[model samples]
Target chain A: MINCKALTKKYGNFVAVNELTFQVQAGEVLGFLGPNGAGKTTTMRILAGFLSPTAGKASVCGFDVETQSTEAKRKIGYLPEGAPSYPEMTSRSFLEFIADSRKISISNRQRRLEEVHELLQLGTVLDQKIDTLSKGFRRRVGLAQAILHDPEVLILDEPTDGLDPNQKHEVRRLINRMSERKIIIISTHLLEEVDAVCNRAIIISDGKILADDSPKNLESKSKFHNAVSVKLLNSMNLNIVDSAINSLPEVASTRIDENNNSLIAFPTKGKTPLEAITKLGAAEGWDFSELHVESGRLDEVFRSITGGTAR
Target chain B: MNGVSAVMRRELRSYFSTPLAYVFIVIFLVLSGWFTFNFGNFYNGGQASLAPFFNYHPWLYLFLVPALSMRLWAEERKTGTIELLLTLPLEMWESVTGKFLASWLFTSMALFLTFPIWITVNYLGDPDNGVILAAYMGSLLMAGGFLAVGSFISATTNNQVIAFILTVVVCFVFLLAGFQPMLSPLVGWVPQTIIDSIASLSFLTHFSSISKGVIDLRDIVYFALLISTFLYANVLVLNMKRGE
Candidate 1:
C-alpha cells in the first residue's frame, strides 16, 4: 500500500532520514521502530505528503507523493505526532469539518462520523470543546478525524504518546481492529505497543532501516541465548555447583547466587542447557524450588539491533 | 463545494470558535462608529454621502486587517497544524483564496455594520444612496487590499506579533505613497508619471476615487489584481516551505 525508495530528508546539512527504502503491503500493520529523532516521523511526514524528501521518491497507494500529492493524500489518513487538533472546536464539529473538506457525501458522512465516534469512544465528549478535553480525549478526537472518511491507509505517528495505560490499551485494540481492512503504519518509541499491535516491525536507526521482520522472528534471532532462573530451597556449596555445571559439555558458563541459592547458566553448542540442568540436579541431589525459561523479549531484540536504549 | 469555498467556510467557522472573531468585530464597529460621530464630524461633512464613514476606513483597516490576517498562517505554524493542512488534497491556491475571502468577508460584515451612519445621513439630509453604495464598495476593496498584504506578511513567519508588525509596516508604506505632505519632498525631482504610479498604488488614491461614486475600471482592476497577486505569492510561499 505504501512504498518508499531511497527516501532521504535533509534539513540543510543535517539528514533526518537517509536513503531508506521499504514497502508495506495491503492490510499489513507495519511498526516503524526507532529511537527519538531516528527519522521515523520525518519518513512518515514525507509519506503523508506533509514534508518533501530532500532526495528520492515515495508513493502511497500507487500515487507518487511529490507529483500526485493530492491523490496520495486522499488515500491516507494521517494522525500526526502529538495528535494536534483545533482546540476551539468540538469533537463533532471538527470531524464534520474534516468530512466536508474531504468532500464526503452527506448520507455517508453521518454514518462515518458515527463510526469514528463509536470506534474512538468519543460519543460523550463529542459536544465538548477539544480544549476542555484531556490529552487522551484530544488524541482520540484527532484519531476520529483521521478515520472519519476511512482512507485506504492510516499513517499514525506516535498514536498513543501521552495516554494512560488503559487508554493506550484501548487505542491499541482499536488499531488492531482497524488493521483488518486498512494498511496501518505506526511510529512509536514504545516497544510494547508494537508488540501488542503490530505483526511486522521495522527498526530504524540513524535514518537507516536496521531490521525488518515479524516480531517473533526478530525475538528469536536476537535471543539465541536463553536465560533460565532457578531458586533453591537450601544452601548449596557454590564451588561444587559451579564445578559440576562447568564440567558438563552443554554448559558454557555458570554463575551462582549463593544468597538466593540460584543458578544462572548459559548453554554450550550442540547441546541444550536443559539437559545439563537436569543432569546436574540429578547427580548433585540438590533441592530446587523454582525453574522457569522465557524466550527473548522485544526490548532485548530492539536494543541489540538498534544498538541503543529505546527512547 | 469548490476548494476556495470549503476553506472559507472552515475559516469562518474558526473565527466564531474563539474570542478572536467577536473581539475584532466589536473593536472595528466601536472605533468606526466613534470616528464617524466625533472625528469625522458626520453632522457637518456638509454633504449627502458616506464621506465621513469611508474616510476613516483606510486607517481602521490599517489596524483591523492585520489583527484578522496575522493568525492566518502564523498560528497554524505555531501549533504545528500547518503540516496537516498543507498536506490536504486541496491545491495551495484554493486554501489561500478560501482563507483570504473569509477574512475579507468578515471585514466587510464589520464595515457594513456602519450602515446606520448611512441611514442617519439619509434621515437628516439629501444623501445620494448610489454614492453611499459606491463608497461601501471602495471601502471593501481597500480592505481587501490591506488583507491581501496582511496575508502575504503572515505567511512569512510563525509569530503572530511579527506578522502583525510586518503587515502594518507594509500597509504604512502603501498609505504613505499618496500622503501629500509625506511624498511632497520627492515631487520636484521625480517625473509626474512615476509620481502618478506611486500615488496610484496608494490605498487613498483608488479608494478615495471610488468613494466619490466613480467605479473606474482601473481602480476596480487594481484591487482585484492586487489581491490575486498577493494570494498567488502566498501559495508560492506555502509550496516553497513544504517542498523544502
Candidate 2:
C-alpha cells in the first residue's frame, strides 16, 4: 500500500501541492487528473522520493519516503515526466545499466530483462540508440526500466502523453496486465484513460483534490447522467424534438444540440427518462436516427468540476 | 560499490560514445607537447629529465580538465536523466564520486599516453626514473584536484558553458593564489597567518613541491584533501539542488 498523509510542497512562497492526502491499496490503479500546473507532477515527485514534502509524510510499502527513502525507493518503479532517459545509450545498454544499478543478481538478471522486454515489447529496438527511436519506443524503454526490478509500487507521470492512439492503447494494456499485483498511480489529464484503466480517479485543480471516487461515480455526478438523448434526421426538427421531450413528466429539463441534429432531455430527480422518451417518440411518429440514455459526459463533468478556477 | 561502479561504467561509456573523448585526448597530447618543447625548451635544457613536461601540467589541466568535467552533472540536468538517476536506490555520494572517478581515470589514461616522452628522455640520458614516477603521481593528483573542483561547479548549473567558465575562473584562482604578483597587494592588508594559509591551499604550491624529486606526504595529503573537499561539496550541492 502507498500512504500519503497531508502531503504539502512549497516552492518558496507558492504552494505547489497543498495539504494533499490519499492512500493507494494493492491491486489498485489510481489515475491522478489535474490541469497543467495543478500540482500533479509535484505530488508524484514527492511520492517517488524525488522531492521532500514541507509538511505531512508519505510512505511506500510501509517504508517512509523521506526518512527511509532508500528502502522505499527499492520497491518503487517511478517513470518521471517525459520518460527521461539517456539519449546516448542504446536501449539494451540502458536497461542493463538500470539492472546493474539496482543490483539485480547475475542469475536473476536475464529473467528480469526478458520479462520487461516481453512486457514492453522492446525486442526490435533493443540495439537502437534511444536518441533515434520514436517517442513511443522511448516511452516504452522508460517503462521497461521502471519495471526492470519488478517493483511493487509503480508511479508513472504522464505515461501516454505523447503517444498515438494505437500506442496509447498498447501502454494501457501493459498497465492493466501489471495492475493485478502492483499499486500503480498514473497522472494524466486524459479523462477517458481514467474510464479505461483506473478503478479510481482523483481530480485536482489549483493544488487541491476536488473529487476522488470511482470513475463511474464521478461521471454519475454529471448533469447528463441518465439523461435521454435523441438524434433526428433533420436539424430543422430540433424545436419539435425539444418541446416534445420536455413535455414528458419525468424530464426535468431539455437541451438542443443543433450541430449533431440531436436533443438531450435531462431526467428529473431519481428518474430515467429513456423509457418515457421512447414512448413519446412512438406516439408522435417521430423519425429518430439515434436515441440512447447517457450514463454521463465525462468532459462536461470535468469542465464543470474543474472549470472557472484559478491555477 | 554496485551503485558507484554502475554509474562510473555508464559515465565512461558515455564519454567514449561521443567524439568528445578522442578530441580531448588529441588536443591534450598536442598541447602538452607544444608547451613542453616550445615554451619550456626541452631540447635546449638538455637535462634528460621531463621537467619541461611536468612543469606545464598544472596549466594544461586548467583548461582541459574543466572541459571534461563540465558534462558530469550539467548534462544529466540538461537531458533530464538526473531524475532517473537520483530516484534509483543509490545514495548521493555514490553518483558524485562515481562520476569523479570516471573523469579521473580518463585523465589518467591521457596522462599515461605521454609515456613515450618518458621513454624518450630515458633513452637520451640517464635520469632518475623514480623522480619521474613521483612527478607522474603528482601530476595525476593535481589533475584529480582540478577535476574534483570542476565537478562541483558542474553540479551548480545545467548549462555546460557556464559550468566550464566558472570552473576555469575558480581553478585560475587556485593556480595563482601562491604567486608573488597576485599576493603582493594582499601581503600588507591580510594577516600573516591568513596569507600563509591561503598560500598553503594553492595547487601550484603543493604540485610544484612534489616535482622537486620528492613525493612529500604533506603534498599528497594536500591533493587528497583538495579532492575530497570539493567532492564532498559536490554532494552537498546535489543534495540541495536535487538536480533542479
Candidate 3:
C-alpha cells in the first residue's frame, strides 16, 4: 500500500531523514521504533505527502507523493506528531471541516462523523472546543479526524505519546481493531506497544533502518539468547553446585544471584539448558525451587538495534 | 466542496470562534468612524460626500489587515497544524485560496460595518450615493489587496509578530510608491512613462480613482490582478517552505 525509494529530506545543512527506503503491505501493522530524533516523524511526514522528499520518490496506493499528492493523500489518514488540531474549533465542527475538505459527500458526512466519534470515544466532547480538552481527549480528537474518511492507510506518529496507561491500552485496542483492511504504520518509541499491537517492527536510528522483523524474531536475535534462572532450596554446597553446573559441556557461563542464591546460566549454541539442568540435577541431586527460561524482551531487542535506551 | 472554498469556510469559522475576528471588527469599526467624523472634522468641513471617510481607508488597512492576516499560515506552522492541513487530499492552491477568501470576507465584514458613515453623509447632504457605492467597492478591493500581501508574508514565517511587521513594511512601500515628494525627482531621472507607471502601481492611485465614483476597468482589473498575484505567490511560498 505504500512504497518509498531512497527517500531523503534535509533542511539546509541539517538532514532530517536520509536515504531511507521501506514499504508496507496492505493490512499490516508496521511499528516504527526509534529513539528521539531518529527521523521517524520526518519519514512519516514524507510518506503522508506533507513534505516532499529531498532526493528520492514516495508513492502511496500507486500514486506519486510529489506529483500526484492529492490522490496519494486521499488514500492515507495521517495523525501527525503531537496530535495538532485547531484549538478554536469544536470537535464536531473540526471533523466536519476536515470531512468537507477531504471531499466526503454530504449525504454520508453525518454518519461518518458519528462513526469516528464513536470509534475514538469522542461523543461527549463533540460540542467542546479542542483547546478546552485534556491532552488524551485532544489526541483522540486528532485520531477521529484522521480516520473519519476511512482512508486505506493510517500513518499515526506517536499515537499514544502523552496518554496514561489506560488510555494507551484503549488506543492499542483501537489500533488492533482497525488492523484488518488498513495499512497501519505507527511511529512510536513504545517498544511494548509494538509487541502488543504490531505484527512487524522496524528499528530506526540516525535516519537509517537498523533492523526490521517480527517482534518475536527481534527478541530471539538478542544477545541474551535462551538464558534461564534456577533458584535453589538453600541447602546445597555452593562449591559443589558451582562445579557440577560448570562441568556441563553446554553450560557456557554461570553466576549465582547473591541475594537469592539463584543460579543464572548461559548455554552455548546447539545445547539445551533445560536438558543440561535436568541431567545436572540427577547427577548432583541439587534442590531447586524455581527454574524459568525465556527469550529476551522486545525492549532489549530495540535497545540492541538502536544503540540507545528507548525512552 | 472545492478545496479552496473548504479552507475559506474553515478560516471564516476560526475567526468567529475566537475573539480575534470580533476584536478586529470592533477596532476596525471604531477607528473607521473616529477617522471620518472626529479626526477628519466631518461637521467642521460639512462634506457632501464620503470623501473624508474613504480617504483614510489605505491608512486603516495598512495596520488592520496585517493583524487579521498575521496568524493565517504562521499560526498553523507554529502550532504544527500545517502538517495536518497539508497532508490532506486538497491541493496547495485550494488551501491558499480558501484561507485568503476567509480572511478577506472577515475583513469585508469589518469594512461593511462602516456603512453608517455612508448613511450619515447622505443624511447630512445630497451626497452622490453612486460615489458612496463606488467607494465601498474600492475599500473592499483595497482591503483585498492588502490582505493578499499580508497572507503572502504570513506564509513565510511561524511568528505572527514577524508576519505582522513584515507585512506592514511591505504594504508601506506599496502605499508610498505614488508619493509625489518621493517620486517627483525620480521622474526627471527616469522616463516620465516609467515614473507614472510606478505611481499607478500604488494602491492609493488606483483606489482613489475608484473612490471618486469612476469605476475604471483598469483600476478594477488592477486590484483583482494584484490580489490574484499575491495569492499565487502565497501558494508558492507555502509549497516551497513545506517542500523537503
Candidate 4:
C-alpha cells in the first residue's frame, strides 16, 4: 500500500510536485500517467525514499518515507528511470549484491536470484557485464533487481520504456501476475500500457492530479463512448440511412463518413442507438455490412486530460 | 551493518573486476619505488631505516589517493547508480562508510604490496623494524585521511576529473600547511598562534611525528579526527543529495 498526502517537492523557485495526494491499495496496478515535468518521476523518487519531499509526507506500507526511510525502503522495490545499473559488474553479481543489500537470507538469496533470473530470462547474460547487454536486456535486469526481493510495494518508473513490444508485453504480464499480492505503481507516458496492464489509472499534469479512476472509467469520459457507427452496403443510400438513424428519439445527431460509406450516430444521454438502428434497418430493409459501438478511446481521454502535451 | 558490508563487498568486487585496480596498484608501486630509490636517494642514504620510503608518501598519496577516491562516489553518480544505491534499505552513513572502507582497503593493499621494499631494506641491512612498522601504520592512516577528504569531495560532484582536481587542491593545502616556504609569507601578517594551529592541521606534520616511530596519541588522534570529520561530511553531503 502507498499513501501520499499533500506531497510537494520543490527545487529552488520551481515546484516539481505540487500539493498532490493519492493512495494505492494492495493488489492494485495503478498506472501513473503524466507529461514530462509533471512530477511523476519526482513523486516516484519520493515514494522510493530516494528523494525527500520538500513538504508533506509519503509512506509505503505504512512506514513514513522520510522519518522511517530504511524500514519504508525495505518494503519497496524501486526501478528508477533509465534503469541505471553498475556497468562493470555482471548482471548476476549485481542482483546478488542487491539481494544482499536487501538483507535476503543467505538460504533464500540464491533461490530468489535464480527465480528472478529465470523470470526475466537473464540466463544468457547472467555472467556478462551489464554494459554489454542490449537496452532491452538492461531494462530487464533493472526489472529483475526490483522484483528480486519481492517487496510488498513495487514502484517502477517507466518499467517498459526501452523494451521491445514482446518484452513490454512480457513485463506487463509479469506485473499483472504479481498484481494480485503486491501494490504495483508504474509511471508511464504510454497510454496503451495503462490499458494493457493497469486496473486503475491516475493522470497528472503540471504537478497536479487531473484524473484518477479505472482505465475504463477514464475511457468512458471520452466523446466516443456509447457512440455507434454503421457501414452501409452499396445498395443503401447514405442520406436515407443517416436521416433515418438521426430521426430516432435516442439519436442526438448523425454524420456520414463518405470515404468509408458509413453512417456514425451520436446518442443522447442514457440512450442506446443500437436497438433503434436495428429496428429501423429491419423495417426499411436497409442493408448494412457492419455495425458496432465504441466503449471509448484512451488516447483521446489522455490527450484531453494531459492537455495534449508531449511527454 | 549488513547494508554496509554489502556495499563494501560490491565496491571491492568492482575495483578488482575492472583494469582500474591493477593499473592503480602498478602505478602506485612503481611511483613509490622510483621516489624511494631516485628522488629520496634510498641507496645513497646508507641508512637501514625506511625513512626515504615513508618520506615520499605524503607527496605520492596527493595524486594517487585522489585517483582512487575520485571514482568512489563520482562514478556512482555519473552512472546514475546512486539512485539504485540510495533507494535501497541502506542508511546514508552505511553506504558512505562502506565505500570509504573499500577504497581504504584497496589503498592498504597497494601499500602492503610495497612489502618487498621493506624486505629489501631488512635484507641489505639491520633496519629499525619497529620504527619501520610504525611508519607503515602512519602512512596508511595518512592515506585514509586523504581518501576521506577525497571521498567527501567526490560525493559533491558527478565528474571524476573535477573531484580529482578539487581533492588535489585541498590535499595540497593540507600537505603544505606546516611547510616553511608556505608558512613564511603568513608569519609576518598573521598571529603566531593562528600559524601554529594551521600547521598543526597539516598531514605532513602528524605523519612526520608518527614516522619517527614515537606513535604519539596526538598524532594518531589527528589522523583519526581528520578521517572522521571528512567521512562525517561525506554522510552530510549524501543526506543533502537525498533532499535535493
lDDT of each: 0.85, 0.90, 0.87, 0.92
Per-residue error for B118 in candidate 2, Å, reads 1.1
Candidate 1 chain A, poorest ten consecutive residues by summed lDDT: A221-230
Candidate that would win on TM-score: 2
Superposed Cα deviation of residue B187, candidate 2 (Å): 2.4
List clashing residue pairs in candidate 4: none
Q: State the displacement of the C-alpha of residue A216, model 3, in Å, after optimal TM-score superposition.
A: 1.4
Residue B237 in candidate 1 has what lDDT?
88
Off by over 4 Å in 3: A232-244, A260-263, A282-287, A309-311, B184-193
TM-score of 4: 0.95
Off by over 4 Å in 2: A309-311
- Which candidate leads in DockQ? 3
**For model 2 chain A, where is the 10-residue window of minimal lDDT?**
A302-311
Q: Pick the candidate with the highest lDDT.
A: 4
Flag clash pairs in model 1.
none
Query: Model 3 in CAPRI terms: which quality?
Result: high
Per-candidate interface DockQ score: 0.68, 0.66, 0.81, 0.78
Candidate 1 segments whose C-alpha is farther than 4 A from its true place: A223-225, A234-247, A254-264, A268-271, A309-311, B180-196
List the candidate numbers ranked by lDDT, top first: 4, 2, 3, 1
Clashes of each: 0, 0, 1, 0
The residue-by-residue lDDT of candidate 1 on A247-309, one tens digit each, is 777777777888887876666644567756766787779776877654557887788777865
Please state the error at residue B234 of candidate 2 in Å.
1.0
Any residue pairs clashing in model 2, and if so which?
A: none
lDDT per residue for candidate 3 within A1-311, as digits (tens), equals: 78889999888888878888888898799999888998999999988987888899888999999999899999999999999999999998999999999999989888998899888888788999999999999999989988889889999999998999999999999999999989999998878898889999888888888998988889887645676678887776665676677777887888877578787677777466877787778776788888877675777777767786542
Per-residue lDDT tens digits of candidate 2, residues A116-225?
99888899999988999999899999999999999999999999988999989999998998999999999988888998899999998888999899999988988889
